[model samples]
Target: MSSYEENYLARRPEYLCHMCGKCCRVVTTSIPYKELKKRSQKGEKGASDFLSLFEPYESIEVARKVDAAVVDNIINRLIDDGNYNEEEITFYCCKYLGDDNLCSRYHTRLTLCRHCPSSPWSIVPPGCGFEGWLFWQREQEKQKVRLLKEELIELELLKHRTSDSQMLDKIDSVQSKIRKNINLYKRYGSENW
Candidate 1:
């Protein structure tokens, strides 16, 4: 589970979604849907889990017109990262969304759908109530990344002071370790963090 999911569940486990169905209308992934399907066919766990619950939008332009937030926030962010290829970015919607932006399976929604848009960087609708929450989540992640970088600098100094090769090697390994934590927020532009 993500730290956000764990912490939030510990504090507020009861699911309290606004039910805008905008999250249902706008789903995306770093990889193209075709590749996702291919990965699913190859028994990739993440691809299988996501595809089993969501279905791709039949018309990209139509989906864009229906809710430009996904296009603006998600697609544009991918473009800025130099990963722009409209065909490579697919939008999706939860198959369970019913009329008037309600979840058809409100009582037994998938856990993933329950905590959908698990982070602030997720492409939610413009007016979705989680806007402030998302901002706070991003700030938390940014701060964590900054702290990791700080520890990395200390590790760099420790490496120079150590004569033991094993200890020096541990410092290198820890740098990689810290980077793994930092990369979790790289999608939110944590490079500067």
Candidate 2:
């Protein structure tokens, strides 16, 4: 099964899309559009993949026409997140989305579109079908962080109690990477979670 399908089975029931197409019609990102464009120009893979499939709406009003609630939800979430600078947040829509809420180039849709809602925390339209899935994913993440915290404590104790410098160095490296991974959720208040 595809990773998305696997996630559906593992967490929520068989996933069912409401077909509002709000996700494809309106999308936003913490990454600014200008920076994405610059990175695409510089041949960055993620940026290039994004710009390849999605283009900016001619203006915010144009995006609003496509799905105002989705657009407004994204903007409001970004504002509330507190980590994002107001000007640095950006939104875009798939040019391939059709009036019937179908993808014009479904077979050839880019990976970014195919694998959208990249995480549980992705801000989607208010009533998207993935809402329950997202909530389950967040709870899964919290459990993971809790486990990592326990592991980190053990690693710290091992490092200090052992005189093997090489082993201690390895332990330190593992701890560092784990902390880095955890911090990705820190913006969601992982520290307090």
Candidate 3:
């Protein structure tokens, strides 16, 4: 991971969690359940770790019944982001969640559970305590991408004003790095920003 990601993770406020258990009650992965199972069997750490604790609901309707707000929030966010696909979506619930909205295996919870809301772009349940924090984090990332894009434009101008092979090569290298940084947020619609 990049230092920026490391810093963001380090700064995440665990205290912000409301412990409402909505997130634990209803969660969805980007891939289908079958693919996730295949990946887990193949020893993919993320998939394996996720399935180690979470089991797929019989259907999305069942998941919504478990926690309608969270399920709806996730679906709405996916739709808004142009990433919704009913065929590939699969909701899962933690097998270890207790009736009191606490983890049955709190002490031994997997890293995936511990890292809930793992990124700024995580689609947390509506009214979640981390909602504001996640939004701010996302804005910070967008701003960083915007700044990098501006830098790329500056570099382009510099290239146009320079004829030296060594200087042009240096400009090209810097532009590549800046573009790579911006590309990191391409999925988040960084181009529109």
Give the CA lDDT, 0 to 100, for residue 110 in model 1.
70
Which lDDT tens digits does candidate 2 get at residues 89-110? Answer: 5567777788899888888887
Candidate with top lDDT is 3
How many pairs of residues collide in model 3? 0
Q: Against the true structure, what is each candidate's TM-score?
A: 0.75, 0.75, 0.93
Q: Where does candidate 3 have its weakest 10-residue lDDT segment? A: 1-10
- 1-193: candidate 3 lDDT, tens digit per residue: 7675578777999899978888888899888888999998999999998888888888889988878888888899989988899988999888899999999899988878877788899888888899999999889988888888889888999998989999999999989988887888899889899
How well does model 3 score by local distance difference test?
0.88
Q: Tell me the tens digit of each residue's lDDT in model 1 across 96-171.
A: 7787888877888776776666655665667777766767777876787898989999998898888999998888
**Could you tell which candidate, 1 or 3, scores higher by TM-score?**
3
Candidate 1 regions with alpha-carbon error over 4 angstroms: 1-4, 8-16, 43-45, 155-176, 183-188
Let me know the TM-score candidate 3 reaches against the reference structure.
0.93
Clashing pairs in 3: none
